[model samples]
Target: MSEIGIRTSGLSPYVALPAELESLENLGISEYQRAAKITDRMRPGIDIPILGLFGEVGSLLAALKKQTRDHPDREKYAASIKEELGDTLWYLANIASRTDQDLDVLAQRTVRSISDWDEVQPNFGTFDDIQSNIKELTQSEFEAILITLAGRVGDLVKDLGSGALTNNRDRLSGHLVDIFGNLLTAADAARISLGEAATANLLKVFSRWPLTEEYPPLIDDGMPDNEQIPRKFEILIEERKINGKIYVQQKLNGVIIGDRLTDNKREKDDFRFHDVFHMSYAVFLGWSPVLRNLLHLKRKSDPIIDENEDGARALLIEEGVSTFIFQRAIDRDFFKGQTQVDYDLLKSIRDFTRGFEVDRCALWQWEKAILEACRIFSELKRYRKGYIAADLISHTLEFRRVPEDRRED
Candidate 1:
């Protein structure tokens, strides 16, 4: 990754973790402060984490906004809130660490501000009494607590802007204590678990970017070669204008596979070639139900694995996630020159793929797949025809221009 350059905090930034991993049931503030220290060691100061707090708080409020004012997808909304609260908590802990403040004490002195805040409180108790206790709150009650959270975040922002935070060590510490308290208040309003939030956040943050890089363990180690996504493969993806409409087709070895594809919209957006994204999933994540189906690589020898992991249902989910991210990328000019996908986009993709085999893959793996695919997708768009190759063992993708003689369809 260092060769081509992997994403970092500045750019937006791997690991294989156990399925039932990351339990922080009795996680203490001090311990959490340490765990949240995944920032780039090169950039020291309270700035990055403090700015991250602002963005996370905004996302938390946006989730609440959608839940309250829009037709919320209840499950997605809930996952989003859990993730946002956890992120808010991490930045708060990160702030504490950078400022040399005590999250333990900040948590203890949390003023207990909201009326029903106790009911919505997170799992992290006072440093001496780490525990999880929560009761649901009415929409109005959640609103009140979250509104208070906004104010506290505003105070922290003021501290950051005032320059007092950088110049006065004592003042920064005070601001951190207050911010940590409101972090609990935000968790309460969301009725999220702090221990769970912190743990989940650690899973996500550590997984998405690298402090120490760890490539994912392949999912097809013992599977039959024909049933497994090939360790190395190349496919010819070519575009042609037939009947005044552009279409894309793919070929492996000497045989064609799958029907030719188009954007299938009133507008031609080059989505016809989106299968490039799937090829990417196969290479980086070691999971793509669509590719399994297309290449006849489904694990039929294990009927249950075939039925569940490589079934129609999983294929649809993968397709849906591709479309979802494609639309998001469209908005940003397809992430032109960008190295990473944003947190919310990754979060939503994570929620969408929650039950599938791909769920085992980490966020960074997903980001890598998406970014690499988009890179090739961009190249494919520019040249109109290319040979996209992959070496699955190395988990790398390459796009090579087709020879001029071969470019003619």
Candidate 2:
């Protein structure tokens, strides 16, 4: 291991190398070497770190695209992001190794730079202070905060140059801190501790499709097993009706609301309205025989050749639309009273939203902005053509499964 080649005794001086980077340096693997090992081929003078970094970034983006486009489980989606980030870190570490840099030193410099920036820009406080203040924000203020946070994430994605990855670790770290700072702030405001929120998210995941949740579980021949194959689009469509009913009922029971809104008439009315949205979505999906049995869906014995058009993603989008409408209703005092359940569910959904790359927050304003575009997209489609786009907007807004399919693995 080489010395960091920097002063370590002065006040706020550069620190030694991080343990992981030291280990990487010990392995004597350079960026070009690792690139060759992974690719088994290389172009001359190609920036391996840049290539690897962008590739990983693309992987993260693709996973997000699939999540929105295909509507897989939230935890699975989160895990995909985590996987890509880890890969990105590998490339980052390789870049450092090739350049004989120290991550600890880079990190300290980043903190110092941020501290200086904070002094200059008094409005943006320290990260911890920002988190503490998130809960104190008014609805409108929180909405603005979410928008700013989103813009920062976009900036980070765009600024990921290969040179930046190797020589500008401090700058990259600053972007990461900003992103995570906003996420943690939102999590704090949502009232659930990170641990609790994570647990809740996991519970939601395991409760849904526990068996085939991870990468659809490939078979020995690399093809999905006949029994373990993903559910058909038609089946999922029917399942949504039962699932939607179950969810609305559960939501009614779970939340502590005023007597005015809890009346049978009100509850029934709300559920019916929610059902209309689903029915409208079904209409948008071209009204096949599968969707025609909207009110009463029965089990089919036939092995239908599923189009696998990624309806789960559409289901998520529809739920976002419903949530957006419901939140607006809440603003209009539709809910006579309430407790924590409303906010908890809202935060979970917001954090779980794909393509946006954000965490839990009180305001749905961020989602509302994106949802408007989705609404426009939905309007452009002619019935059946809308299914794919709608799936990206919704999936996992409800829970539905037949008795035989509900067994634990």
Candidate 3:
């Protein structure tokens, strides 16, 4: 229970949180203010919406600070803060409407995101409750969800480029800004004030990877290709029959690490995905699980790559990051005859990323990783102008040497 009449569940703070949704709707701005011609003096359509959205955010923060610190009356301060928040929502709703974006989509996506932590949600109430639920919410799960979200964001960008919604116009920003309403509701459901979430994220980053006087390059400008990836890993195709139906999967070094299928040795295109991307990405982020759990399904034991419940999470994230490269290859018609295994991976990633409410502390890290990943992809595009695809993958994976020090195992 929160002071704002918002209710949270063990499943997620935002999952179907009606009170938060209703509160956001109630925070409507006056039609008179929306029609004001003051912004018409400037950039008109572009400047007004953008400024209105951010300006209201600023105002909301200011009011919150005053309410928490300067105001003497607690009840009055709470009421004032709620009104300020409503003002912010009014601007966000206007932004969504201007861009023809769907608030329902936004709400659903936000709800799903936070729900990823459903396993831990039932065990605790506050952020401090996280410490006790650390085992259930391990680093593997965190990394998995992070990768999945990153991939979804990438796919969204690709869609935007393909003129899926707003075309190639600046309305793209408007579409992106539409998620703010759901995000606010998510914050409420997660039991953390938006201000606290932002501040905590900032402090977490500053405490760990502090800013340096001279920042390092995105990818190290190094010497030789021989040192890029230290060793090679095998990608083996295996087949199994489940209830009279045969299914194929991709295995890395004898382990059924992925769910992709490669038909036969003659199918050269089946080997399109480079294990280097998945392996190096996991190791670099220290999301690799220490123990491999073998589950008994029938006669032969099946190796579950996901170390625990959370390891399944890391796998999903890995798939998202890996999917961008794979999807790009397919889009470019690089692999003409590859066996179609799981086309729904992107859809899954998108559905989850959109619905999942980001964690209070990890949100900042996820954003940083996503931006850096975009830059990496851009660099890869420039370097692979004429080179072989393998070289491109190798060079890209070279950016982060496997962080052996951080490896859980």
TM-score of each: 0.80, 0.25, 0.26
User: What does candidate 3's lDDT look like per residue over 138-213, in tens digits?
Assistant: 3344334323333433444455456564444344543443334333533343233544332222222221232321
Which candidate should be chosen as best, given lDDT against the real structure?
1
lDDT of 2: 0.36
**On residues 204-225, what C-alpha lDDT tens digit does candidate 1 reach at each position?**
7677765544665577778887
Query: Could you tell me how far off, in angstroms, the CA of residue 88 lies in candidate 1 after the best superposition?
Result: 2.0
Q: Please, what is the whole-model Cα lDDT of each candidate in the order they appear? A: 0.75, 0.36, 0.35
How many collisions per candidate? 2, 17, 14
Q: Which ten residues in a row have the lowest lDDT in candidate 1?
A: 3-12
Candidate order (lDDT): 1, 2, 3
Show where candidate 2 strays beyond 4 Å: 1-46, 114-409
In candidate 3, which residue ranges exceed 4 Å CA deviation? Answer: 1-194, 200-271, 289-317, 324-396, 399-409
List candidate 1 stretches off by more than 4 Å. 1-26, 40-44, 70-78, 108-142, 159-167, 185-191, 241-246, 407-409
Best first by TM-score, ranked: 1, 3, 2
